[model samples]
Target: MQQKGGAAPSLFRNGFLQTILLSNVLLQIGIWVRNFAILLYVSETTAKDPYAISLISVAEFAPIFVFSFIGGTFADRWRPKRTMVWCDLLSAVSVFAVLLTIHFGSWHFVYLVTFISAILSQFSQPSGMRLFKRHVPEEQLQQGMALFQSMMAIFMVLGPMLGTFVYSTFGLETSIAVMGVVFLLSALVLVRLPKDEQEPRTEEGKGQFRREFVEGFRYVWHSPVLRMLGAAFILAGLAVGVAQALGLFVVTERLGKTEEFLQYMLMVNGAAMLIGGGIVAVFAKRVAPQILLAIGMVVGAVCTILVGYSTSVPVTLVVQFVNGLVFPCIHIGISTMILQWSHASIVGRVNGVLNPMFVGMMVVSMSLAGPLKDAFSLVSIYVGSGLLFLFGALMMIPIMGHKAPEKAQAAAPAPAAVRTEP
Candidate 1:
């Protein structure tokens, strides 16, 4: 869909958006069911063995680190629509395979359901980004990202409930079956996406995979905007990781509430996210992504400090709500900026290179947060996290006036996408 004159294309009318959003909804249903069902089943079957429980988490997350770049490289080389469809189909096939294995007294094999899907998603997610870059008008990128994030926010509030209800009411076998079915449906929904444009072939195929992967890094390093964003990603990851690790402490030690109260805080945050997403989507065209990102980080810094320092329940909750509200800005702005700054052909690789920066640093900081907590006061840790947020905001300053660069020619290398000015 193309923009007419200066008017943005109708997002709801766009076939890509319609299909992808519906596919994502089905995907979310399957994912949450798989997540909660597996967790509960593993807990009961293993008698809540700590190692077994930890292994479940490892199965879900480890693949992101291992296969992200590899998957991204393939996504760039492959047709995005086909890649996404195959990933979902494979995920469904794996889930059903796990279900069958469970029936034969091999219940421990259930971890493969999470592991395989997680690995496939590394391939699938980047392909979706590639499709997004190819299909979405640059003017509507932020709005589209906001809308997508808002749907995820809705899931954050409802997903656990839905998963728990299904597992509790229907048992493990049925939950697994449901997950398989949902994934199948998501694959079907994706069939409605517009056909992928055929690229002209030359005697030489898309460059060597290894060479392209290395170029992804070089691409980010050379772009002043992307370079700053990478640094921001690291700082933001560190800040978020520490805050996430210590959030329970804020609920208990600071607010003098039990651990269960954390759910209520999450609920408030989720509700605020829905509202924030709406606000951002409405005003998307008015603000540049860098400014939006910087503002979000600054607000996050203030809220982080307040949440740590507040002793009153209402005050802490309010700060938590505000934090939830602006959280979408951070995500939407980042996604929009990446799409705007990178060439369409290299979107997958750029996402692959950047996502790991955030997730890897977050994981490292999360591990360190425990040790830091042992040595420092909770308030002090919160203040430090806030400082990290401030630093992340400062990283945006260099790119504040930048606009989306002109789309590079399909044959251009990654670095050719870089534009020195707005």
Candidate 2:
């Protein structure tokens, strides 16, 4: 399981890895372009109506809640490469359908398109996770995941700007067409990936869909480390919910800043994430995943508290940037742990179960955040979020003392099972 001679493998040198990364970059760009274009289009058409904007968020969230687990079950049962390619092709078709609706002046169909695409993405995500688990070497798993995360970080910074520019220059119809093309390109590139070697199914896994779904839940519930991780994820979701609900008010009402300043704060944080991802890609192997999680949580809690207390724009920006910097560490640590601990056969369902826990909690937290904000001062909400983060960090402490199971280590899939480009 160790690296060959303990030297880091060159990720770019692996043709399969290169194909995945390139395809992912294009896919991400298309997603961001579509997201921002739709948001801007909605805002302008609806006169900045809050309800309309909320509908877009709901469209994105509801699919994850409803279809993620189902998607995971299918991903496990299906071929990973085929699942991913078909998902991409379906997404492109959805975009084209949206374009046709737009041509017919049925703008309401846009929401339906978004929902369908989100549903397809649920399938694609777990398929991608399964691919990473099968293909990436055990010792270099963290590095591979970190590099993938860094691409996301870069896209977060660039996507919105690019979306806005394209929308402004070409209008909605043209922008939608571009998104369709980008998705098709992503599918074509994914076709270059070799077919996955299918593993034999066990008797326990052969059954009704309901049983398979419940099995995923049971597996995670039985694993002590996974149980703790799920608790931390819920708490982290609550913290995020609090921040999302009250962040604007804290900036404008409490600190007397403008929307422009808020945008600057976001850009700074995005840039910090890009830099932090680079650090993780280079040094993630040297640190234990549990230790990395603890450090990220502690640092995030402190910075979040500082952000609440600071009145000066410069001070708030600095703390927010630092918060973003450590954020990737938390993600990389958790993802690597999931890949290492879960059996390849059920990894898709495991991811599906875990993702909804975080998102569902965020939905619950968002519901509560509004009432809590109306009752207490915004600073109070921020401080409460910091406490929640601290609680999550405390939950990680026990994990630091524990070790991965020897059986899990022995069960790790061989690299030969993962086919790369010849």
Candidate 3:
């Protein structure tokens, strides 16, 4: 796993090169804006709780649990570029439809739009990732992954500010319209992806999509390594959601800040994500995925413990930054390992299983976060999450280990082990 440590390798050139970068940027912009619009519209227009926001966290991501297997199969069978293009086009059209509904003063459309976006997003993401694997070379996979993570980091870091500005300067509808345009732009960029060998077109490809979805899940059920990886991700997502759901509460109560401090807390943590992105790009492959996963869980655990005790914004920021750097390494490693273990044809199915496995856990985690916070304490949440991460790290010890004759374990190096999904 060791390689040159200081810089990422060269991996892209030409118009096709610009295409990947630009498309990633556009996709992030569209995602951020669309999510922002939903949150804002909920806070302002909805009167169910007077200041009611639909408690749709569960509904939002839980669909991936249901749809990932189908989407994954499709991603594997179809021409990836065309698949991604259609997904983006669907996104653009869907966003535009929401905008029209809003313009016509129909708040009722929000629920339908939200569900549509959720389902369509699963199709777009796995197909888009398939393009990354097809175009990027094996030797440069680490750098490619790092750069991809960084691209997401930039969008994540900048998205909220830009979305807010658009909404404020123009209007909410203007922001929604901008998201549609970005989706269209992303689709165009995807159109340039170099064609690769098509997947096997068998009767299996035409089988019941639902059955295909179950088949992917069955793959995970059968593989011990994949099962452990899934458990690690499930708990990891839940751990983060617990903390994320309570971030504002942490600062205001512990640091004695008012509600206004929420913005600063969010901004600073977002900035830390940029730091995490850089670390992942520089070290994703240089460090063994297993080793990184171990360190990530350990560091993240320590940060969480520190965060639980921190009494001020500065202390919280430092702990938060530490958590940020490690979390991405863990995430990128899991994703890279999955891609490495998969044949290109089955990559989509693998990703589809992961989409729900990861996202769906967050839904369960968020649902319980409120009850947990009320019953125990925020510090308990942090400590519990940290403990779960430690458990997750320990779980990885067997996964990355090679399955060979017992005699080989003595002769071969004891590879660094961590919880892995691939």
Q: Pick the candidate with the highest lDDT.
A: 1
Candidate 1 RMSD to the correct structure: 3.1
- Candidate 2 residue 122 C-alpha distance from true site, Å: 0.8
Candidate 1 vs candidate 3, TM-score winner: 1
Whole-model lDDT for model 2 versus the true structure? 0.81
TM-scores across all candidates? 0.94, 0.93, 0.87
**Candidate 2 least-lDDT 10 residues:** 413-422
Best by TM-score: 1
lDDT of 1 by residue, 1-422 (tens): 44536766688778889889999999999889889999999999889897899788789878989999889878877888999999999999998988999998688888998999999999999999988877887788889999999999998889888999999999999998998998999999998888877654333444567777887888888788889999999999999989997899988899889998998998899989988999999999888899889999999999998887899999998898999999999999999888888777778888999998898888888879889999999999999999999999999987787766656332234433221122
lDDT of each: 0.86, 0.81, 0.69
Listed per model in order, the count of residue pairs whose N, CA or C atoms clash below 3 Å is 0, 0, 3
Q: Quote the lDDT for 176 in model 3.
A: 76
Q: What's the candidate order when arranged by decreasing lDDT?
A: 1, 2, 3
lDDT tens readout by residue for model 3, 1-422: 11334543356553444687888788787767766766776666664353246444534665687767777777766677787788888978987888788789776566555566677777767876666655655545666666676676666668888777777687677777888899899888888777655444445346456655566666666556567778888877777778777777787888888887777666666667677877777766567666666778878878877787788778888777667766677767777656655555556777888657666767677668889988998888889988877887877788657331222122222111110122
